[model samples]
Target: MRFLVQRVSDSSVEINGEVVGQIGKGFMVLIGVCDSDTKEIADKMVRKMLGLRIFEDEQGKTNLSLDTVGGQLLLISQFTLYANCKKGNRPSFIEAGEPGMAEEMYEYIIARCKEQVEVVERGQFGADMKVSLTNDGPFTIILDSEQL
Candidate 1:
């Protein structure tokens, strides 16, 4: 599993021209899954993500976690995070988890996040979503299961 986390002042997702999910002062996380992923890995990733101290404190130090700042969440599934373009112009998604398993993992992640976050929003698992965000500090982080 991989999570591309972007700290945002606000974010929103749209599907079929209808807003599906939106949030403020939180992380816009694009979650990716692979065949080897499990709930345990997802759990670890969630912990690490929520524990990140990228938010600035009163001293202008990046030392505040999501909980401390009372941040929301906008989680979106993105299989293309596993795109492999080493061969040619076309990218291969063979490393991405199968749709059925990936969707299950996505839902599990969302549920876990909702338990801790006051406001948690998510895009449809298999939908073509249009995501918009104002990246706070232009801060971004990538969390990978293998790295954790």
Candidate 2:
């Protein structure tokens, strides 16, 4: 499992020209599930996304977690995060999990995240969606389950 987390002031996702999900003042999560990913890894990543202290404190220090600031969550499924491009011009997605399994893990992560935040909005899984966001502090981090 892997995730690209970006702190955003506001974000929205549209599928086929219809708004699907949106959020304000939280992290925009682009999640990718690998063939080896399991529920354990998804759970661990959820905890980290909720607990990671990327928000600023009263003193202007980046020391507060999203929970402290009362933020929302915007989660999106993005298998391209695992793209393998070393071999050729066209990126290969052989490392990405099958659609069904990936969808299960994606839903699991979203359900888990709701426990820590006021709201958790998500894009349609496997859809060609349009995502927009005003990145806050331009703060971004990448988390991989294998690294843990």
- Candidate 1, 35-74: lDDT as tens digits: 9999999999999999999999999999999999999999
Superposed model 2: Cα runs more than 4 Å off: none
RMSD of each: 0.5, 0.8
Superposed model 1: Cα runs more than 4 Å off: none
Worst 10 residues of 2 by lDDT: 109-118
* Residue 3 lDDT (model 1): 100
Residue-level lDDT of model 2, residues 15-40, one tens digit each, is: 98998999999899999998789988
Each candidate's clash count: 0, 0
